[model samples]
Target: MSEAWNEGYFTDVGYTYGYYREINPVFQRFCLLLRGLAQPEPAEGTRHCELGFGQGVSVNIHAAANPGRYVATDFNPAHAAHARRLAAASGSEALLVDESFEQLLERDDLPQFDSISLHGIWTWVSRDNHEVIAEFARRHLKPGGIFYNSYNCFPGWSPAYPLRQLFALHDRFGVTPNGAVERVEAALKFSEALLAANPNYLKAAPQLTERLKSIATQNRHYLAHEYFNREWNCMYFTDVVDALAPAKLDWACTASPLDAVDAVNLAEPAQTFLKGVDHPILREQARDYFVNQQFRKDLYVRGAIRLSVAEQREHLLDTRFVLTQPADQVPMKVTGALGEASLQEDLYKPFIEALAADACAPKTLRRLAAGFSGMAWPVLQQIVAVLTGMGAVAPCQPESAEREARTRCRALNRHLCERARYGNEIEFLASPLTGGGISVPRFQQIFLLAREQGRKQPAEWAQFAWGMLDAQGQRILKDGKALESAEENLAELTTQAGEFAEKRLPVLKALGVV
Candidate 1:
C-alpha cells in the first residue's frame, strides 16, 4: 500500500470503460435460467449492491434499467462522484457511497442485499479488504441471494505473472515522479527493452513478450490500474471458493451463458474426465486448467433454492428475447477455448430471424418455438442461451419495469449523449427493454442526440456532429491519420451517419437506445 494513495484499490486514473452484464439481475437471471439454476426475481423491491462499483456504470445502469433499489460503494470519492453523477442524471435512487469496505461492513443501517456483485477488484486489494468483503456478503446478503464475483484468476494469467511483477518493480524503483500513467509507460518501455535483450526468462516465457507488446498499445490509465498497483493477486478457483465459504455462498453456474455449454469451454478429453469428479469446486478448477482460463465471471448463491425441471422449463418459456443486432449480421462463428465453433445455420438462422422480426414485440421461447415446428424445449433453450451468450440477443424486461426503466433510461441517455460532445469515455447507454446497458458508440450517441433534437436526416445529424467537432478543434481519425480537410471529415461522418440511419436507427428505436 502506497502512503501517497489513501484508497486501497487503484483510483489514480479510475477504471476503464467497462460494463459487465452479470451485474444486471434480469440478464444475470436469464443467464442462470440457461443452466437450470433458480434466482429469486425482483419482487420485494429487490435490493442490490456492488462493492467497488468502478465508474458506477454497471450499478447506475442496473438501477436505472430495473425496478430495484441499488446501494453501491466505491472507496475513491472521485469514482463515487462519477457514479453519483450518472445516478442523479438518470433520476435513479441509487445510493452511491464513497466509503471503504470496512466502513461499509461496520454500518448497521444498510439494507440486506438480495444480490451483490463485485467485479475486477477482488484480487487488486489486500487480503484484509477481501476478508471485509466476505464479511459484508455474509451479513448484508440475504439467504438464497446471488453474489457475483469476477477476478483475474490463475492458469490464464500464469504466463504473465512474472511480467506483471516486473512492471510494478520497475515503476517503483526507476520511474520519474510524474504520475501513474507515465510511470506505467516507462515500465512498459523497460519491459519491452528487456524482452529485446532476449533473456532466459523471456526465452522460457515467449507469451509474456507478446503480452508486453499488447500492453504498449493499451490505454495507459488502464495499464496503471491493472499492473501499476501495489497490491495485486490472481488466485485459483479453489482460493475464491475457500474465501467465500464462511459466507455460505456456494458456487452456482457461471454467469456467462456460453460457458454453460461444456462443448465450447472444455476439450472432449477434459469433458469426459470432469464427469467422474462430483465435487463442484474441484471440477471447476479442473475445467479452468483444461481451458487455461485466466479470468472468471462467476455467480455464487447463499442457500440457493433451485427450481424443479418443469418449473425451469415453464419459466424459461415465459421469458422473452429481442435481437440486438440484425439476424443476418449475427455472426455464426463464436470463438472460445476450443477455438471457433460454427453455429448450425439451419437451426440458428430461423431463431435469429424470428427475434429480428419481433424486435419491437419480442417473442417468448414457447411462442418462438412454435414457428420452428418440432423444436423441443431443451434445444430451444440451448440455442437461445448460446445466442444470448454470443451477445447477439438479450432478454426482454417484464412489463412492470418497462415504462419506469424507459423514463430513467431516457433521462440518463440524454445526459450521456450530451457527454459525447466532449469525448466517449463511456460506451454504453441504458436499454429499458433489456434492463441493461447497450453498447452504443460515441458517434451513434451523437447521432441519437441529433435525432432527438429534430435532426431527421442523417446528413443533418452529420452536420450537427461535425459542427461540434470543428468548434472543439477535433478531427476525425481514419487509419491512424486525421482528415486534414473539414470537408473530408464531414464526408466520412455523413457516410457513417447514413448507414446508421438506414440500418441501426430502426434497431435502436426498437430496443429503446434512443
Candidate 2:
C-alpha cells in the first residue's frame, strides 16, 4: 500500500507553510532575470510550470496578470482539487496536473515549458525524488529556461536540527500533543537552568539565553510541527549547488532579492572577500553564514545571459501598484447602500475611513495607524484586506522611492524580529496565526466567523485590534454582544449581508445579469 499522507500528521509534525498573500516582488524579479536569459517579452506567452502548486493562489494571480499557457502540478490530490477550485473561481485558464514529478517528466506528451518553479519542496522530499526533479529540468526545460527552487539552508539551522531530532524521537514514543509541548518547554527550561547555574553563560554568547527564551514562547503548534518532521534536514549551500550541477543548472539569482542585500553589497572589503571565493556554492554559503540566512528562494538558469539592471527594472514595471478611483469618480462596483445605512451607529467609521483612503499602499495604511492610536493593527490589516477584495482599491505599482525604502526597512525589521527575544511576540501576532489581515478576502468572512461565531477574540485579538480603532469602541465583544443597540445589531447584520452581495454582484455584472 502507498504510505498514507495524513494532513494532521503533517500539521502536527512539520513546519507550517508560509502563506504570503501579495505577489512576491522577488519572484517577479526572478522571472525578469529568466526573461533576460531567454530574450522573451511578457506578450510572448512564455510557457511556465510550477511544481507543488499549493492552493494555486499565486498561480491564479499570475495568470490574471500575465496571459500565458501555464501548467501546474502537485502530488496531493486534495491540494490539486483546491488549486482547480481557485483557478475556476478566479477565471484563470491554466492546466493543473495531479501527479508526481517523475511521472510528469516521463510523459512525452507534455509541453516544453520555458520556466519551471519548485518552491519549498526540495528538502522535504526523498533524495531520489530530488534527483528526479533535476532530471526533469534537464530533459524538459527549454535550453534557456529558468528554474526556481526554494529550500532550507544550512549552518544557521545546525543548532535547531538536534532539537528537531529530539522532537521526532518523542513523537515516535506516542507522546500526546500537550506532552510534546511540555517536553520541548522542559528542554528549553533545562537549557535556561543550566545557563543560570553557570554565570559564565556569556562565555559562549550572552544572547543565547534570550534566543532560547524567545523560541520557547513561539506558537506551540509551530514548535511541535517544525521540530518533529521526520525528514527535517539542512544541507550546506555547496551540497545543493553540486546536486544541480549534473543538470547543467547554475544559480542565476535569488528568489528573494532582498537576501542579496548585505554588508557585501555595502562595503568594498566585504565585496572583495566575496569575490575571492572560487566555488559559487561556497561563496553563497559564506555570504549567507556571514549574514545568518535561515530560509531562501533561489533562481537557477540553464545558461548564462546578460541584461543591465535598468532593463530588468523596466521589465518589472507593469501593474506593481494598487489603484483606487475616487469613490464618486467611478460608479461603486459594490453595493454600499447597506454599508452606508449601517455606518450611522457603528463606531468602525474611522476604521472604514482608513480603508477608504483614495489609493493607499499597505505601508501607508500602517503608518497612518499612528493617527488612530486606539485602533488595533490586526483590525486595520483585516479591514484593508477586505476593502482591497471588495474592489475599493486595486493593485498598482509602488511609484515612489519612499515606498521602496519602507519595504526594505520592513524586511530588515522582520529579520531582526526573527532573531530577537521580546520581539518574538510581535512576530507571532503579525503572522498568519493572527490572520495577517491581508489574507482574509472578505470583511463578511471576518464578521460572520469572528463576531457571529464568537471566534478570533482572544487576549491577542485585543492587543491586535487596539492598534486599529479608537479606545472608545475597542472593547472585546462577545458573539452577539458586538451588536449592542438594536440599531447597531441591524447594521452589523446588514453590513455582513451587503459584503456578500458586493462579492457576488461582480460576477453578475461581468455576465450582464445585474
Candidate 3:
C-alpha cells in the first residue's frame, strides 16, 4: 500500500524541478490577451497561490522574478522544505507550506488569492481532492481572478491509457523487488517482450510501441509518480468544465497562448466546422479531437469580463517582452490539425531581427511596432502573439520588476550554482532580467559555478568544473558511459564548454544569469 501522504502521491521520490508559464501573472495576462479574453490585472505586487506546487521551482522563480506576495502548498514536507530553502536563499518572502487542500481551505489567516494555479493537479488525485480544490478556488479566489489548471485529456490519452494500466498492474500483482525505479524498468521490460510476441491489440495500435519508447527516456522519478499513482484520471474537456462550474469558474482561454491561434492549431475545414459549435466546452472538446492533444493547460476566470478591441490592444501593447533566442533559430513552420503549416518569412523577419539587435533589453509592443511600420498593427500583434506562444519570445518584467528581480536572481542563481556541485536536484536558476528560469543542464550549472570564481575563458571554466568533479569523487558521463580518467573528462568538458559559451552564454548574459 502507498503512504497516506498527498493521498497516495509519491513523497519518497520528490517531483522534478518543473516550471509552468501559467503561474506567472504577467505571462497569464499576456496569453489571455492573445486569445482576446479580458484578464484581471496581476503584475508583481499582487497575491498569487499555487496548489500542489511540486518541487516549488515555478513558485520560487516567480517569487524571485517579481514583487508578488506569493503563497504555495505541497502536501509533501520534503518538497515544501526544499522550496522554502530556495526562498530563504533568494531572500524571497513567499509563504510555502506543507498542507493538504482541505486543511488549507479551513485556514482562517490565508489571504484571498488574486490568481490560483494548479499545474496538472486535476489528473493525479482522487475526486474528493478534486472537489476540495474546487471549493478552495470558490472561497479563496477573489472575484474576476484567474485559475490555471492542466490535466490529461481524452482522445489524446486514449492510446497510452492501456500501456499505463499495464505498467500499474505489473507493479501491483507481479513479483517486483526493491524500489519504484526497478519496478518501472521491470514492468517496461516485461511489456516490451510481451508486445514483441505480436498480440492482436498490439499489432492494431502501433502508436503504443512508440509511446512506450518515449516514456522510456523520461526521468524515472517523473514516470514513477505520474504512472504509479493510485488515481490517474484522464477526463474530457466537458468533464473538467463541469467540475469547476460549482466554483463559479468559467473557461477563459488556453493557458498556452499559441493554442489560441486556429490556423496553427486546427486545419481549415475542421477549424471552420468547430467554429459553428456555440458551447465553449463542446468547441474545446471538438478541437481536442482534431489535434489529438494528450495534455491540456487551461485558464478559467471567476466572473470573466470581456475586453473591447481598443482596450485589448492597449493592454497588450503595454506588456513588455524580450527575445530569448537568435533570429535564425526561430522556427518557420508549425504543426496544425491539417498538417504542418509554414509561417510567412516576410512578417517575422523584421521583428526577429529587431529583437536580436537589442538582445536583453525588453521592449514593449508599442516600441516593437515602430520598427515594423510597413506591417499593419493587427498583423504584427498576431505574429508576435504566435511567436510568444511558440516560445521564441517571452513576456518580460516591466521596469518596476527588473531591479528587484535582478538582485534576487543573482542571489538565487549563485546559490543554485553552488548547490550543483553537490547534487542535480535543481536544474533551474532565477534570472531577474528574463524574470524566469531557463533550463540549465547539470554540466552547464557546474560551468556557471566555475565561471563565477574568476574563470573567464571556456577552457578555464572547463578545468575548474573538472577540479570540482574530481574533488567530489565523481566522473562525468558521455553517451551513458563514465570517462576513464580526469584527462578524458576535461577534454569532454572543454568541447561542451566551448559550445555553451558560443551558443548559450549570450542569452544567459542577457537574462542576468551569468
Candidate 4:
C-alpha cells in the first residue's frame, strides 16, 4: 500500500477485471498461422509468463483452460491476492507473485517461457522499466517463442497528447481529495469547463472536444489509471522494434486477427502504396498513419520462421474453429479503417450454419469445406479470418488439450458462477474448447448455478436467482428503472432465463462450461 513500492505506476485504484483474448496461446498461434509465420506448437509442457497481470483474469483463465504452466506477476499486492485466490479455486497450479519487473528479473527459478506477454503496460512505465522488460525477455524467452504486447502508439495520439497533459496538470494543481476516483472526477470537470470556454487550442484541434466528451462517459476506474498515471509515453512502431532489439525480437504480425485482412483495413490505393514499400517495418508504420492508429496489439518472435505455401495450406485444413455467438445473430458486416464493408452472405452464412449445427460444435476447415463442393481454399480461409476478426468465431484447441483441461475449467466456472450470486464485476467464464474466456453475463452464470442445483424449468431458475438477489435487497432493472415489486422482478428474470436456456445454454454446453 506504500507509494514507494508503486514506483511511478498508479496504485490508488485497482485495474479493471478484464479478460483479454489476445493473451491466449491458441489465439496467438492462429494469428501467426494467418500471416504465414511459424508459431510455438501447443504441447503439454508449454509455459507462459505475463508481466503486470492486473486482476489476473486472463492469466488464470488461460492456465485453467489450457494444458500448460503459467507464471505471472502484478506489482499490486491486491491484484496478486485476487489472482492467487482464483488460481487456488481452479486448482490451476499457477505461480503468481506481487513483485515489480526489476524484482522479477532478479529471480533464478523461472523457466524459459514459450510466450511472454504484457498488455497495456509498455507505455505507462518508465524507460528504465522498459529496459528491464526487454532484458527479462532476452533472458527467459525460448528461441522461436512468441512475445505479445499492446500499447498506445503514435500519430493517433499526437493530437490527444495535449488533452492528457491538461488532465495531469489539473490533477497536480487543482484542489481535489486524495482518492483516485475523486481526482479523476475533478480533472474531467475542469477539462469540460475549459472546452466550454472556446479556447484557441480547441479551435486548432476540434477533435479534442468530442474525445474528451467520450472519455467522460467511460469507467472512472479506467480513466483514473489511463489518464492520471505518473509516467506515460507513446511511441512509433519503429521505436518499439528498436526498444526490443536487445531481446533479439523481430516483428512477426498483429495479434488482432482483423489487422491481417488487407481488404477490410486498407483502401485499394493504400494497399497498392503499401505493396510498393519494400521494408516490412516501414510498411507497417506507414499503414498506421493512414488508419490513424492509436492502440496496437502486436506479436514478436525471437527468431522468425516463414512457412511455405504448401505447409500453410496443410495447417489451415487441420486447424479447428467454433462459433462464439449464435450463427444467425452474427453481423454480416465488419468495420475497419475503410469503414463498414458487407460480407458475402452466400459464403459466410453456410460456413457459420455448419459450425452452428450439432449444438454449435467445433469443426475443422477440412470437414467444413467438404460440405461445399466448389469453394476455393483461399476463399474458405478468408471467411474464417473475417469471421474471427468480427469476434463471432474463435480458434479452438485440439480435443486432447480440451479433455485434459476440462476438470480445471469446470472448477473455475463453478467458482465464477458462485461469485456471480454476489456481484457482477467479472463477466467471463473459462472455456476448455477455445482455451480462452467466453463472455457469459452474471445472470446467465446465475442460471448455470440454478441448473447445477437441479432446477430444470425457467420458472424454477428465476425463482432460485430471485431468492439470492432478494436476500441482499437487490432488484432487477427494466427500462433503466428498478422493478419495485417482487412479481415484476420475477417475471423479467423468467423471460431472461427462458431466452438463456433457448439460445445461450446450448453454446455454453458445447464449450464445456455447463
Candidate 5:
C-alpha cells in the first residue's frame, strides 16, 4: 500500500485540514431512494454501512434522518476519530471502525447491512482495493439491499487526464508544496504559450483553458492531495459494471431521478434509435454520445426485485417531511410544456401563488394539495420538483426567535467592518468556532448598535458578508418560526454565544491572537 493509504497520514493532515464536512445532497437522496426500494420495511434493527466514512458528515446526516443502525469504516484513523466526534456531536447512532474495507469484511461479527455506500473512493484507489470493496458488499449486504457508489467517468474526464499527468510530473519534480503549485502554474503557462504559438490549438485550446482554470481555482491543499495521490484513476461506467458483476450486484438505477424521466432522456431521433439497443455497453456508448457524462452516482441492488408504481408512491410518502422552503413562498409561473401537464395544470396557479407567499414546509404543501381536492401525491411531488428546479423553494429547519436575532447581528457586524473599532468586533463575531457559531439574539443586539454607528466601507465587504448572513438567516427563519420576536431572538443569541464560548473558546484561546 502507498503511504497515503496508511491511517496516520490521512488523519494527521487530510481530514482535519480540508473542508470535507459539507453535506452531499446526492447521497442523502440516495438514502431516500433506498428507503423507498426497501419498502414492506426490513425487520427491526436494520443497518447501513458506509465503506469510506471520511469525517462521517454524510453518513451522520443520513443516520440522523433515517431510522437504522449505521456502521462506518475508514482506513484513516484520523478520519475515524473525526467521524466519531461528529456522530457524537450530531447525536447520530453510528459505529465508526478504523479499518480498511478488506479488514472489515474479514470480521465474523459484522451483520449484513441493508444499504452500503461508497463515495469519492473507487476512482482514487487501486484495483485490489476495488476488489476488496466489491467482495465485502457480496459477503455482507443483505439479499435485497442497495449499494450506492459515486465516481469519475470516462470521455468527459479524458481531456483532463493528461493535464493531471502533467501536474503529477511537476509534483514529483518540486521540492516544496508551494514549489509544486508553482510548477503546475508554470506548466499551465507553458500550455497557454503553446496555444498562442499554434493556430491548430483552436480545436483543443478551449478544453485546455477550462482545465487550467479549474486547477487554478482549486485549493492548494486539495490540489496537492488530489493530483499527487498515487492511485487516482477514472473508469468507464460499463467497466465499473463489469468489475462488480463478480459480486452478484447489478445496476438498479442512476441516482439522479431527472435522468430517468423519459422526456429528458429521449429528445431526438438518435435517442430513440439508441434506446432500442439491447447491449448494456452499446447503451452506455449511446448515452455518451447523447451526454458527455463526467461523473455518476450509481445505485445497485443484490436481488432482482422490482416495485410497482403505487408501491413507489407509498414509499415516497413514508419519507420524512423535510422542509426545503418556506410555506408561503409562491413558485414562478411556468410558461413551457410542464412534465405531466395534466398533473400540474390544476395546481400550477395555486402552487405558484402559495410558494410566492413564503417558502413552505413540505407538510404545508401537502396540506395545501389536499385542500385543492384535485391533487395527488405524484402531482404535488412534480410541482415541488418544478418549484425546487426554479430555486423558489428550499429545505429549512425550524429556528427559534433567538436564531433570527443572531443572524441580524451577524449582518450588522459585516456592515461595520469599515469602522476600525467595530471592524475588529465584527471579525471576532465572524469567527467560525466562536462569533460565527454564537446565538442569534445577542449577536443581534451587538449588530444593531454596530449598524447605527459603524463606518461605511469604500468597498463592499458588507454586501458579500450580507449574502452569507442572509443565507444562514433564511435557513434559520424558515426552519424555526419560534424565534420571530426581538426578545426571543436576543435570548436565543445570548444562549448560543454562551454555548460557543464554553465549547469553542479554549481552542480560540490556545490559538491566541484574536
Candidate 6:
C-alpha cells in the first residue's frame, strides 16, 4: 500500500466499521425540522453525498434504507472497495468512489446534491482540502440543500490538544519501525508514562489523566488515525461557519437532536445570556464555550428557510417516529451540558408506553397526539423532541419510502448477517422504518439469519447460532468470561436467543429488518 495517494491522511490501517446515524438524510431532515428550519425531503429522486465515508457503513445503510441516490468518496481504496461490496449486496444505487477531495472537485458529472455530509473530516484535513470541499459544495449542492459537517471543535479540545500533539510527536520521533498497531501502542505507553510522572502540565490540565487512561483502552486503529495523523486541526464553530461560507452555507442547527432542547443543555442564565448575543456566530461560539463543546455534528443550509410556528407544527404532525430501543430500556434521565436531568414521568411514561403499543409500529405524531386527548400539541411536540434527543425514539421516512426500501434493506441485512457468521466487525443492520442502521449484534444477526431460513423457535435459533460459532471454535462470552464447554455456550446462546426473540425480534419485524 502506497502512502502517496492518501496525501497526509493516515492509511496505515482501515478505519472502523461503524455506522453513524447523523449521516442519514432522514435523521438530518429531522434535526432541521426540530429547529423550525426547512430541509429537502428524502424523496425517491433526492441525491446525497458523503465525503470521507470511512468504512462506507453509514453511506451504504442510508442508501439501502432511504429512497435516494447516494454518492460518496473516501481516499482509501480499501474503504471504497468494502463500501462498494455492501452497495452491491444491497443492490443500492450508491456510487462509492476512491477519489481524493481534489479529484472529486474536478468531476463535472455529479448530480446536484440535496444533502452533502462529511463526518469526522473537516478537522483532519488540510486547509486546501477544506477549500476543495467548499468548492464542491458550491458547485454541486442544490439551493436549500442540507450540508452536514462534523468535526472536533475548540474550547472543549483546548485541554486535550496537547495530549493529541504528544501522541503524534511520539509516533513521529520516538517510535521504531513497527506496524501501525504497535506504533499506536507505543505512543499510548509513552503518553501514559509521561502522565504517570505527574508533570506540571497534568496538574494544570487535570482532565488529561482520565483522558489518557481512556485513550489507552480505545481501539488501536482508531487511535492511530485519530491522533497519529499528520494533519489534525481542531477549529472553533465560528471558524467552520466562515470556512463553509464560500459555499453559501448558513448554520441551520446541530445534527445532534438533543442540542435542540435548551432545558437539558443550557441553564436559564446562560440561555438568557446567549439570547442577548445578537450575532448568530457569536452566540453559537459562546454557547459552545458554555457547554465546553468538543465534537459537533452541524447541519448547514445553502439557502436557509425558517418555518413558521404553525407550519412547523403542521410538518411535525405529519412526521412519523419509532422507538429505536425497547421502551423499558430507555432511561428516564438524559444527560447534557447541565448534567443529568430527570424526564417528566407524567409526560414521558404514558407516551413511551403508548409508542410501545401497536406492536411498536411507526406512528405519525398526529395519531399519537390523538391518543393523548388531554395533552396539548405543544406539550406533545416537546415530549417527542426530548425522546428523540435521548436517542430512544427516531424519526422515520415517509411510508411510501419505507415500503420501497424493504427489498434493499432485507438484502443488505441478509448480507450483514451472512458476514456475521464469520466476523463481528459490522454490528448494525439497515432498518427501513427509521431510515438508518439499527444495532444488531453478531449473534442477533445470526439469529435473524436462522429465522429467515424458517427456523421457528428460539431454541432452534440458539442451536443454529451455536453451530456457526462452535465450528469456528468460538465460545459464548457471558459477563466478560468465555464459557468453558459446549453445554455452557449453548445454554448462554439459548438464553440470549430467547431474550432476542422476546425483546428485539418484534421491533426488528416492525422495522422491516426481519
Per-residue lDDT of model 5, residues 1-514, tens digit only: 3464562222224442221111222233433343245422433366888887665655654444344467889887777886676566535457899888778888998888887888777877778888998898888888877778888888768766766676555545644344645654665555455556654545764577666776778665456555656677688888888898877887766655445433434556756887699985668656755566778777777874666767666555444232222223333343221233222445566665543332222334444555566676666666555453343333222133123223333343333333332222222222111111211232333333343454232112233333334445621242546555444544544464454344333332221111
Consecutive 10-residue window with the lowest summed lDDT within model 6: 1-10
| Candidate 6 wrong stretches, greater than 4 Å | none
Q: Rate the local accuracy (lDDT) of all candidates.
A: 0.85, 0.49, 0.82, 0.92, 0.53, 0.90
Candidate 4: lDDT of 474? 98
lDDT of 3 by residue, 453-489 (tens): 8788999989988888899899988899999798899
Question: How do all the candidates rank in terms of lDDT, highest first?
Answer: 4, 6, 1, 3, 5, 2
lDDT of 5: 0.53
Pairs in steric clash, model 3: none
Per-residue lDDT over 1-514 for candidate 4, one digit per residue giving the tens place of the 0 to 100 score: 4569888678888999999999999999999999999877878898999999999999999999998899999999999999999999999999999999999999999999999999999989999999999999999999999999999999989988988898889988889778888899999999999989999988779999999999999999998889888889899988999999999999999988888788888988999999999999999999999888999899999999999988888887898889888777899999987899999998899999999998898889889989986998778888888999888999999899999899999999999999999999889999999999999999999999999999999899999999999999999988999998999999999999999988888888888777
Q: How big is the positional error of residue 147 in model 4, measured in Å on the Cα after superposition?
A: 0.1
For this target, which candidate reaches the highest lDDT against the unseen true structure? 4
Q: How far is candidate 3 from the true structure (C-alpha RMSD, Å)?
A: 2.4
lDDT of 6 by residue, 1-514 (tens): 4568887788989999998999988999998998899868778888899999999999999999999789999989999999999999999979999999999989888999999999999888999899999999999999999999999999999998999998888877994456989888888889889889889987789999898888888898998789888899899999999999999999998988778788889989999999899987798899998999999999999999999999998899899889888888889999989999998998899999888899998888888888899998777877888888878898999889999899999999999999999999999999998889999999999998999899989999999999999999998878899998989988989999999999888888877787
Model 5 TM-score on a 0 to 1 scale = 0.64
Candidate 4 regions exceeding 4 Å error are none
* TM-score, every prediction: 0.96, 0.57, 0.93, 0.98, 0.64, 0.98
> 3 or 6, which is superior by lDDT?
6
Candidate 6: C-alpha RMSD to true structure equals 1.2
Q: How far does residue 505 in candidate 4 sit from its true spot (Å)?
A: 0.7
